[model samples]
Target: MVEAVHTAVAGRVRYRVAGLKRAPELKKLLEFRLSRTPDVTHVSASDLTGTLLVCFNSGNTVEGLAGRIAAIVEEYRSHGGGLAPGDNPGKEAGWLDTVPGLTPAYEAIKGLFALGGEQPREPWHTLTPEEVLARFGTSPDTGLSAGRAREHLTTYGANLLPESQPRSSWEIFFGQFQSLPVALLGAAAGLSLLTGGVVDALLIAGVVVANAFIGYKTESEAEKTIRSLQTQVRPTALVIRDGRMSEISAAEVTLGDLVVLRPGTYVPADARVVAAHHLSVDESALTGESLAVTKTEQPLVGVDLPLGDRRNMAFLGTTVVRGRGSGVVVATGLRTAFGGISTQVREVGETKTPLQGRLDSFSRVIALAVLGVTALVVLLGLLAGEAPRTGSEYARRFTWARAAEL
Candidate 1:
């Protein structure tokens, strides 16, 4: 049932629903019921704020709508409604008490995957430092202790995207043969074998293998170059751990880790600014904004704000060109925006090029032609050659007649 009601804007009334913090499903149920009411143009609910927005039809008023909606909700609850199908309220409180971190994880997951889930891209520009700390379950004074940090690292895994397993040389070589031209070459080799052209078949097979190897070698070399560049650019980070400051490899930084940002230092992970001093970041690498952005510590209101406008968040791989600040690392490795992109690069399946598509069509035509030619050759051979079986049958019959006469 609604705990309170207030006008959020003209023609829009907001209801503070009770028990929404515990029973998130109630929000949807409440929305479902409220939207069905006549003259209600729209209904939207936020479990985070325990509020629902109800818009009335033009010329219609929400003057008495709040009381009416509240009465409907209270009647529904009085009749034992709004419970999840399998839920037993009697045991829910006990389970919540027994489970450590279950409630928080539930809330986090809800915020992460909900319709408007996912923390603001640049929350630093939108959220206060204390709010940031509260959001991540950390403190500004002491930072996360060693034990807690280790637990989070273990739970979330290293703050990085999983490295794709290196493809074996044979795998790379075979992958090149997946193309249309190679398929056509394979068909040609098979036809040669069927026609008793053993040497010719072997020659075509050799060419196909050589071409695969050349493509593999070229790809492998390019990967090697990229790896070398990555090693050369690998950055170090300054972080506060167990209440003391230390410099560590960027890869070691994990979620909830407090990272110290300074001018001329590369951002180690995706983090929100908790403290800043004229903090201006050169985000051109990520946002293409040539001018360094000035950041501040203030809570922002809204959802899904753009990255460039999220002046409070610092992304990994970006350099702090001016000023210095501290940020709580919210994402590491593959979970970071940069890492998300890298994972996409690896997971995206290769698409057929336009040339490959045309070549595939050509290969189909060639295969059909080969089949037609082979059938014609076989027909001609059968017509020209004597029938061995018929000749044998006649010889056997003549032998049998001779034996009987003798």
Candidate 2:
């Protein structure tokens, strides 16, 4: 039930529903339902704040609105289609977590962070080839001069997956303990030890160790496979450097260089097409979509278009499945659209998978619950005069030798 333990108003009314916190689906449902409510000017729900904030028409009473909210919550719970996704979800599994660079989750997480970038940059696809070239201070015919290319190369770094923040064996092992439930388990273990429950503490510690060890082993192997994949041959690209067409390692392709794309060749960097000879790219590797997206050199008119709709631009790492095109490299390396994109390498390392983000959020909820319950249990035990009797008060007649005996 959605009970409002607290309500306050300062233009927007806040309904504090502690139950909604940590439940992403519930938050979404509440926001969706409340947004359509009559006289409501704005509705916002935050899982982090555990509150439903609504700005209704000044004429409507807060109590009346909250009543409707409560009804909506109750009705949904009483209905058949109200269940959150995977209410029958399997046990938590990190065994299948992305190995960093070569998975769909890798792309998804990158897109999430990019879409949430601090300041969404203006779309490059809106500008014509001449404007795009002018913006980068380079030319289509001559490309970047050798000096300018070297300068941009230094600034943007290599056209490669950054090796920054490569987690160590120890880091991976300890990451298992980074969750909230594990933290609660640790606290419970400490309390058990302090209360002279040596056996209990040992058991709790063992569970924590076993969990971490298993996660460590699994993630270790996954990352090891990633490392092996990284060692494979780096692709090469044909580029015009200082007005001379030269073949270079894809990693050597820098910003503003003119890259010639042919069928079967992977797009080495995110580029704005200057010329297209009936180009159609297999963007499946990058977009997880069709093998054929027709490319165009003409400017596309749209606002925040999806990756697939940006026909005027080519993404890094996607393949040219048919025809040929030449583009001016706009962004290389981590800044490319293949995921893990930003203006800097640090942000790339900091980006987490959606699964990881959700898990972390859920863990916070579990930890809070554990803390509250632990405090309550202690309070009740103390009230009942069952304060823990440690070393001095232990008696052979009273104490059980085995934990199971208790």
The whole-model lDDT of each prediction reads 0.66, 0.68
TM-score of each: 0.53, 0.48
TM-score of 2: 0.48
Candidate 1: regions farther than 4 A off: 1-125, 134-142, 227-233, 342-347, 352-406
Query: Which regions in candidate 2 have their CA more than 4 angstroms from the true location?
Result: 1-148, 154-164, 178-211, 242-244, 285-288, 299-307, 333-406
Please name the candidate that would achieve the greatest lDDT relative to the true structure.
Answer: 2
- What is candidate 2's lDDT per residue for 1-406, written digit by digit as tens? 4445444654567777645655555554565556556677666676655667777786677778878778756654554224455763562432113222222212222223212222124578998999878877787888888777666665556566655445888889888887667766676667667767677678877878997899999998887567545433346688887789865557667778889889988788889998999999988877789669999999988878898899989998788988887998877666677646434445444778899899788767765654565557657878999865654233211222222111
Ten contiguous residues minimizing lDDT sum, candidate 2: 397-406
True-structure lDDT of candidate 2:
0.68
lDDT (tens digit, per residue) of candidate 1 on 1-406: 5544777578787778775544545554565556556677666666555666777876556656767667655654654555655665564442223323332323232222212213234435566788778866787977877667665655665544455565667777778878655675676666556655566567677877887778999988776556444433435688887789875546556678888889998898888888999999998988899999997766666657787888788998789988999999887776677877786887786577999788778776765565566456546756988333553333332222222211
Residue 115 accuracy (lDDT) in model 1: 21
lDDT of 2 at 354: 100
